[model samples]
Target chain A: MSNIIRFIIKYNLVFFFLLFEVFSFYLLISYNQHHKETFLKSSGNVTASLLQLSSGFTDYFSLKEANEELSRENAYLRTLLPDNKIDKEIDDIYSIMEDSVEYIYRPAKIINNSVNRLHNYITLNKGERDGINRGDGVISARGVVGVVRYTSQNYSTVLSLLNTQLKISAKLKESNFFGTLEWNGKSYQHAILSEIPAHATVSTGDAVVSSGYSTIFPEGILIGTIQDYELISGEGFYNIRVKLSVDFKNLTYVEAVKKINKKEQLNLENRTLND
Target chain B: MISSLGKYIVNFIIIILAQVLILNNIDFGIYINPFLYLLIILSLPVNISNWLLFTTGFITGLIIDAFTNSIGLHASATVFLCFTRPYILKYFAPRDGYEPGSLPVPSHFGNAWFFKYILIGITAHHFFLFFTEAFTFTDFTTTLSKIVASTIVTSLIIMIAQMFGKRNKRR
Candidate 1:
C-alpha cells in the first residue's frame, strides 16, 4: 500500500495531464457533433455578451455600407410594389390570390461571423425573444445565408453555408433539376452542387436557387450562378461549381425565415413514416 | 507594481479579447488563420508546475473554443501543446537553466530561441488542430497545406509583435 501510494503520488502530474486530455477529447467526440449545442450549453451567454459588446462599437464603421445595402434592397422591394406595375385593366378585379404567406421573416443584425474556418457560424442579435428559433432559415436580400441552429433568450447562432457539414438542396433555375449544394471548405465565395445528372443541360452562368424541398427555406431564393462543371469519371452526376451571391465577409443584416406550418409538416411526415 | 500572476491575468484577458473580437473576424482567407491566442500559453512563467501548465492550456483553449464554437478542437490541440512544452523547454534549456520567474518572450529569451520556441509550439498546435478538423487522412495533403500555412503565419505575427513590443530592460 505504501509503495502504491508513493507511485501514485509520483505519477500524479501524468495522471492530471491524462485526465484533462481525456476530458477534452471526450468533449470533442461527444459534444462536437457539428449540429449540437455543445458550446452553447455552457458559456454561450458569456461569450455572446462579449461579442455583442464589441460589435456595438465596431458596427459604426460599417454603418454607411449597411445603409447602402438597405437602400438597395428597399429600391428592389419598391419595384415589386403593386403601384409600380402598369395600370392594367383589373381582370376579374377579385382574382383569387394564389399562395398565401407561408413564411415569416424577421430581420436580425449579425454580431459575429467568420468565413476562414473549416466550419463557421454566424451569431445574430435576434433570438427566442425576437421569435427566432432553431431550424429557421436565414437569408439576405442578395441570397440564402444559413440556418439558425441554437438560440438563447436574446441571441442565436446560425450554421453558415460555408461550413462543410451543411448540405443545401438547390436547383439549376433554367432546368429545375435539383442537387445537393455544399461548401468545399476551400473558398467562401463558392460552393459545389453534386449529384446533378449529366443528361441535364447545365452551363456556366446558369442561375442556382433554393429548391425549398425542406421546411427550412422557401422555394426560389437565389443562391448563385454556375461557375463551372464537369462529369465525374465513374459517376453519371456532374459536379458543378457555383459562385455564391452572398459575400459572407460583408454580411451585416439578414432575415430569419420561420416556416409557419413546420410542426404540422414534420408531424405529418413522421405519421406517414409510421403508417 | 503588478504581481507576476496579475500580469499573466492581464495578458490573458487582453489576448483573448483581441483574438475573439479582431483576429477571429479577419477574413484572411482559408490558408492564413493565425491563432494569436497561442500567445497566452506561450507567455507563461518558466517555473510554473506541470498541473498549472496543463490546466492553463486546457482552460484557455476551451474559452477560445467557446467563442469560435469549435468546442473541443482547440482544447485538444492546446492540451497536446502543453504536453510538449516542458519537453521543448528542457531540451532547449541553457547551461545555466531558466531563471525562476522569466517568461518565454523575446525580451526574456534571445531572439533566436524565442523564434524557435514559438515556431515549434505553434506548428504543433496548428498541425493537430487542422488535421483533427479535417478528421480524415484522405485530405492529408490539404490539411497539411493548411497546417503549414497557418503555422507560418502565426509564427510570423508573433515575431513581428515581439519586434514592436517595448524591449524589456535586460536583467
Candidate 2:
C-alpha cells in the first residue's frame, strides 16, 4: 500500500540503522556461539595470509630479542643436561624415545597478536598443515602462552592466557599446591591464581608453573613468579597474584605442543566421567 | 588534489593500516590504546546518507576485526558509533548547523568544536568497545579505567591528527 511506502520513506534511516545493528549483532553472537564451527572459516585464510605479510616486516625489528630469548631457553636446556658426561648416550635415548614422546613442539611465528582487548587472541603462522590443531598448547621460549582455539590449513589462532575465558592450570612450585590461573582483565603483567587452599604456605616471590594435571601442558613449565597473596576468610581460598614471565608485548616466536596420545588420554577421561 | 570522496577512501585505507600495523604494535601496555581509526568515521560528511554511513561504519569495523581476529567485536562497536553519531552531531552542532556536504574536521569546524566532537564520539566508541569485549560489568572499575585511559589517549591522538592538514578556506 502507498501508506506503508510512506511510512518506510519517512523512517527509512531508523529502519536501516536497526537492520544493520541486527545483522551485525547476529554476526557477533553467532561467532561467540559457533566459535569452533565457523570462526576460522569466516576470517580464516585470507586474513591470516595478510597478517603474515605484515608480520614479515615487523618480525625483523624483534629478531635480536627473539634470538636472545631462544638462547636463554637453550641455556636453561643446556644446564638441564651437563655437556661432556653423557651427550651421546642422551642423544641416542632421545632418538629411541622420539616415537613415543608425549609432547611434540613445533616452532611457529606469531603473525598477529593483541593484548589490549579483554578477550585477546594470538594468531600463528603454523596450522593444520604444520601439524598444529585445535586445543593444542602453545608456549614461548619463556613460558606457557595459550592454547590453540582454531586452525586453518596453514594458520591458527591461540586463545591467549591473557584472555578472560582461558583458565590455565597452575601450581606453586614450592609446595606443588595447585590452582586455576586466570586474568583479572587488569594488566598484562599479572594474573590471579584462585582455588588455592587458604592453608597452603604461599609467599611473595614463590614460583608458579603448569601443574600438568591438564594434559595440554607437560609438568613443570614455568608460568610466573608470585607477587602477592591474600586470604578470603569466607571463601577459604587464597587469591595469589602471579607476575607472568612471557612478555606478550614482544612475543614473536612460539612452539605448538602436540601430545602424541592426547586422543587416548581424553577418551579415557571422558569414558571415566561418563560413568 | 583528489576529490573529497577519493580522499575519504584513501583515509579509510591508511587509517586501517596504521591501526593494525603500527598503532596496534606500539605496545602502549594495558592502559593506553590509541584508536585513530575512528578518524575515518568521525570525518564523514555531515549530510551523507544514513544508510551509507551505517554501512561504512560496519564495514570499517569488520575490516579491523578481520585483521585482529575478533570477527564481530569491532564491527558491533563501530555500528553503535555510527548509529549514535548523528545525534552526537546534533548535540554539539553549530547554532546554524553544519554546511551541507561539508566534512567534520577541525579545519572546517574550528579546534574547540572539533575537540569536543572527538571527545564525545571517542568516549562512546571506546566504552562500547571495551565493555562489549569484557562482556560483563562485573569488574566495573578496571573496565572503566581502561575506557577512561584509552579515551584520553585516542582523543589526543585524533586531535593531533586534526592539527595537521589545515584547510585553506579563503582559497
Which candidate gets the maximum TM-score versus the true structure?
1
B87: Cα error in model 2, Å: 1.5
Off by over 4 Å in 2: A1-4, A37-43, A61-98, B165-171
Q: Write the per-residue lDDT of candidate 2 for residues B39-93, one digit (tens) a residue.
A: 8898888888988998899899888877766777888888888878888999988
Measured by DockQ, the strongest candidate is 1
Model 1 lDDT per residue over A118-183, tens place: 889999888998778999999988999999888988889989999988999999998999999999
Angstrom error at residue B120, model 1 = 1.0
RMSD of 1: 4.9
**Fraction of real interface contacts that model 2 preserves:** 0.50
lDDT of each: 0.82, 0.81
Model 2 lDDT per residue over A1-275, tens place: 99999999888778877887787778878877776466433228777777778777655565747764774465335333432123334453334333535666677778788887777889887888877889999987799999998888898889999998899999999899999999987888899999999889999999999998888987788899989889998999999999999998878778887666788899999999999
